[model samples]
Target: MISIQRSQHSPIGLQLGPSSATLVQLAGSRQNRVVHAIAQEQFELDEKQSIEERDANIAAQIRQILSDHHFKGRHVISCLGSQELFIQNVRLPQLPVDEIAKVVAWEAEERLPYPLAEAELRHLPAGQVRQESNTKQEVILLACHTGILKRHLDLLEQAGLTAVAIDVEPSATLRCFHNSSNDVQTNATNCYLNFGDAATTVIFADQQNVLFLKYIMQGSNHLDHAVAENLDLPLKEAIRLRKIVTNSPTLDASDELHRSVIDSIRSILETISTEVENCLRYYKVTFRGKKLDQLIVTGNESSPWLIEFLSDRLSTECKMGNPFESLKCWPTSTSILERPGRWTTAMGLAMKEKSNS
Candidate 1:
């Protein structure tokens, strides 16, 4: 199981995705808090490096970055994408936190695809579920394997950075919204779609109720490849062009290469629509009373046009997710906080500290 003696407060948050790594540091005080965000320099593993070598290098680079920034000895919370872990909404007889382990083990036999011993297990009590016909009450259980976690922690330890909390990226993303949105819409059905490097995570929750979750294997890399193929350029050059186009309207959005990129985006939209609809359908069947109210998009791979396209296709009102947008910050930190949507996971990891307080 993922070991935790007691949760330690971490001011620095590291969100490592397949494509890029984001670092967020808490700056200033309680009265005038701000975030020092860095997204430009990311650790990219060499394809030629072995798994052990790559993990070591990732840790080393992270440490070097911290040293260079003069951010030594700061507690750091590392995060993992949903694709790397397994999560199931298991229904079990309601019991105290300490007693849930045996139940988790019993459920793991049926729920987990691998051997029970091969994975580490963890669970959170998601309230009680009382059945009308029977007197027995059940609670939601969340389980995660240890093997998946060690891979991430091993890398961090190798890097010379102290890992405080390891978080699920989707949970972290949703936590960002939960912290930002007031109780006015507390019970409303909300969905957060995080477009990470290797995959996309869709989280649908209603206040304390988590209804749907899915990770799709689609991502922005397809667009990169499409641009490269059509432009007859290397992948790196294509990525450069893609960013240039996004930042400036100088290039023709209708050019042959750009059209290919657009097509790739459309494909992503199709999958998102299908997956979201499936979730909505399941939610409707299970939770007949609640209705979905909003959809938010985040992650470095997300694009405004993608949201617009999906909104039109799904006929659901969509908005950019900027968890830090409404939060108070210092004047000098305004520029860094401009793109708040991209920092959802990091902000959420940092918010864990706030929750403990």
Candidate 2:
């Protein structure tokens, strides 16, 4: 069964992506916290491999990564990929807390693309709204395919890890931002962007709730591919060049090849910028009169160039999100400040509080 309980002891937060896995461990409470460990690994699966063979390979890689990091816990909290879950916000007539679930489930049946019986559903009451004479409640609904959830659980079990809770990725990313931001209690709206290997997630939220969310099927991998094709370099070389560009802001424009690579990167950023603008426009239409206060970018793929470009393109203050901003790191812990974007989901998963249930 999928569980949502919290861990009193240190629990590992493991994020399994299409091409990588990230793990983070934290100890102590929110008031006084320390990062225990953080580690990431990339793995490959051959297209010709059988399903069982692929799973075994992934489990093996995870086991090795855990051992390498010396991660201390067996209990873990994990997140479902964006493609594996369906999330939506709905409004329902205000009712007793006990009656909300039934109505939300009924609404899910009508809105969700899949049959309700094949999905596991969860809902959180966001807030109340006044509609006509009656009050209405806004709820965020999340549903995951039962089969996909089971496969993830089984994979973890096979890797000798016990999953204590399963959360959606977008929510996990939002949690990281909310916990780390100094202005989290403010009423200003904030937008968060998390760029993954093959996808990017956009989340618009305020001090109290999530206002909008969307997933775009474009990310750093596209940039890597573009660079590879333009520079006639292997994928690994393209990735290395991309990192060099991100790390060195002052590129010597004298080199034709270097300029070409930069141009390709800019083109990809333009595509991402357009999508972000679209999301912002949608939010404006849905929540009239409220404007985004800032845009925060995170994820392994986030870079200096992308952040600056997006800031100018959107005409909104843009900054990098640090998942460890609020937490202290152990003296021996690896440098989390180096690539904070990659750990947002894992850190957020580690910050989960005990459920009332």
**Candidate No. with top lDDT:** 2
193 Cα displacement, candidate 2 (Å): 1.0
Candidate 2 lDDT: 0.78
Q: Which one wins on TM-score?
A: 2
Q: Candidate 1, 158: how far from true, in Å?
A: 2.1
Q: Write candidate 1's Cα lDDT for 125-184 as tens digits.
A: 444443554333234444556776788777777766677787777667766666443332
Per-residue alpha-carbon lDDT of model 2 for 1-357, expressed as tens digits? 899966444689888887679998887767777877788777876869987888889999999988998888688899888777788878887689999899989999999888999999988665654556666677888888898889999999989999988877777777775645455435678898998777788887775367776778787678888999988898878988887776554556896756878887777778888999998887775665666788889887666666777888998888888777766543354455655678888888887766611
Q: What TM-score, computed on C-alpha atoms, does each candidate reach?
A: 0.82, 0.86
- Which ten residues in a row are the worst by lDDT in model 2? 328-337
Once superposed on the true structure, which residue ranges of model 2 sit more than 4 Å away at CA? Answer: 1-9, 89-97, 124-138, 179-187, 249-258, 289-291, 330-335
lDDT scores of the candidates, listed in order: 0.65, 0.78
